[model samples]
Target: MSWELVSGLETHVELSTNTKIFCGCTTKFGGEPNTNCCPICIGLPGTLPKLNRQVVHYAIMAGLATHCTINNVSKMDRKNYVYPDLPKAYQISQYDKPLCEHGYIQLDNGRKIGITRIHIEEDAGKLVHEHGDTFVDYNRGGVPLIEIVSEPDIRSIAEAREYVEKLQMIMKHIGVSDCKMQEGSLRCDVNISVRPEGSNEFGTRTEIKNMNSFTNMEKAMAYEYDRQIDLLESGGKVTQETLRWNPDEGITTPMRGKEDAHDYRYFREPDLVTIYTTDEEIEAIRQELPELPDARIARYESDFGLPEADAQLLVKYRKIAEYFEAAGEGLANKKTVANFILGQIFRTLVTDEEKENGAVAIPPEYLHDLAKLLEDGKIKMNLAKTTLDKMLETGKPCTDFISEQDMGDIDEDTLRTICQSVVDNNPKAVADFKGGKDKAVKALIGQVMKQTRGKADGRKAEAMMVDMMNDME
Candidate 1:
């Protein structure tokens, strides 16, 4: 019997605010275990909680970016739960009235996974089980979080991965969160189940708690899907429980039975008033939003003439996209700026984390100046590339490495003579290029570049060589 997979993701994004959601505690990532905490964040008595105004603004921004309808009025509720890491034994969150609803994140394959709700909540602390002893740290407690719950519209692991990726990209681009999975700023809980193919009715589903990385998410979901199908095939029942993914052992271990809404015992909070937003407020926030990834990607392709893959890669990270936009400002060849970043500048920051951090030392104007030289026909691409490497290495301008003597391209007649000499001297390379080894022309161009001291344009040199080859024919 064929079985199909069904899944939904509950993603928690830590807002990029300076303070905790309901207190003045610093929301910095790392500190001495409990040094960053205070009375209100740890729920001390006689201390009242105050909601951070920036948190609400960021939540609304997240809603607008994801195409969700922002609710004008919403209130906070106490979510009752017992946990060692939660100082209050109940987290402040929303139940019936959330900030955003009925949004969807579209995948690259044109599939829209419906987002159920995006609600603001407080984060719990961390528990470290060391040497069979448990230790708790309350530093992360009361941190602001926005829970993005998606409808069970995901039918495969690819959709699940893309959904998370799209969310990560959107949140980062909107400047609300860094969305770093490794830093615990972004987390996921996946609900997965399997049913007989072509069946509409849902089956018993188990939740996988806190998948941090894409590799783990994919592996855990695939394992759980197969596990459910096998159980159903053997006439065994699929249990509704929350499971922990053991990455080393590659299996899902049951943690506890799944709880419904009533399990939380939610109630309206007395300390906080209802959040009200006027049309003017929402519109004001809307106007503050920067260009989102999809829109920027489209403009990069349509206006800047970048390939889809290049445009997507550039827009994947906010800092890189910003740098590219600034570097390519008022330039005729925008792709040249992209090439400098993707080709040479990226080589300096070899890791994705480094690239995402935009660690390239050279300023955008340095690249813009170098590309400008290329544009004005004053410098060949080879010289521009070499000068860029120097600028990146020394944090100097292109003029620092390239002197006035090296600033001019060879005249057309002079370039024609160099090309003829290259063709005549490299008879074997020319024969190979004529015999259909297109890359063989590089050797001929190398000779011309060497003779001209890198002042000869490789493209024009190659074109002149092709013209020479045509004359021979």
Candidate 2:
């Protein structure tokens, strides 16, 4: 029997603030293993956890950015559990009293995914397992986290990926979280199950953890869906358990039985005071939100007259979108700016896979100036690429770098003279062009570019070559 995949996600994005959520420990990743821990974060005696006001502000900002109803009052609850990672044996998390609720994000296909709730929580410490012993690092124990829970509205792997991507972009654009999955800052837990199409009741779901990257999230969901379907077809029942994704094996292995809500034994923390927000605060955060990716993508298309694909490309990153907007200023042809941003500037920085992760440190204004130079035709497209590579190397503007290196575009009169010299040299190619061999004309163009040291405009050279060759014919 065929089965329909059903999935939901719980994403915990570490807030970008420097300090932990409940204490003042440094939240910076990759310190000397456990040096960043402190009394309150590690649950020492005579130390009490104090809420980070910035974390609350960011959580509300995230709520507003995603079109959620902000709860004016929220408080923390202690979630009791026994784990090697959590030092307190109970994570201070929000249960029924989340900061935000009743939110939704629209998918590209026009389907809206309902966000059940968003709560503020503290991250647990990490466990490092060695051959003979295990170590605990409480550096991340009290780090700020926003747990975004989505309804089981996703039906396909592509939909799940899109939702996660949109959420990540929104959070990044709002300046709340860095959402860097590699640093364990941003993590996702995928709950997946499959049932026959048009089934009223949902099937048992398995929770997959440690899906640190977006690609792994998609792969894990797909694998779990198939695994559940195969089991049901063979008269095997799905088990409710916590599964670990072995990215190397591309499969989810059952780790242990899932913990229910009562397993945590949550209760309000009497040590900390209740949190309250006023309308003024919500309005303040709402007004401070920058233009999100979806809104910016629409503006890029409708207002700037860019193609849908180009708009999507430019608006994917907040930095790139701002650069494009600034470069388009006072320019008659916004389309030209769009082309330069998408084709030249972004292409230069995102060359290798590592660069795609923001490795290359080329400044935005440098790219803006590079686009401006290309717009003015002070440099040809080929020379622009060379200038870009150099700028990427030295972080200099294309104009200054080109002037310093004397890599200007070849002059038009000099290019025509070179074209003539090319026609004079390649006699066989000229004969072939006159005999109607269209491919033979490219040979003359190559000769002109070669004679000019590839500084000539290729199209102009082709035109000059065509005209000179036609005169001989």
Q: For residues 221-249, could you state the per-residue lDDT of candidate 2 as single tens digits?
A: 87888889888988999988889999999
lDDT of 1 by residue, 1-473 (tens): 89989999999999999999998889999888998899988888888889999999999999999999999999999989888889888899998999999999988888899999999999999999999999988999999999999999999999999999999999998989998899889999999999889999999999999999999999999999999998999999998888999999999998864453238788998889999988899989999999989999999999999999999999998899999998999999999999989998988988988888988898898889999998988988888888889899999989898888788968899999989988988888888988989998898888988888789878888998987986786
Q: Per-residue error at 221 for model 1, in Å?
A: 0.3
TM-scores of the models, in the given order?
0.93, 0.88
* Candidate 2 lDDT: 0.82
For candidate 2, the TM-score is 0.88
TM-score of 1: 0.93
- In candidate 1, which residue ranges exceed 4 Å CA deviation? 257-262, 416-441, 459-473
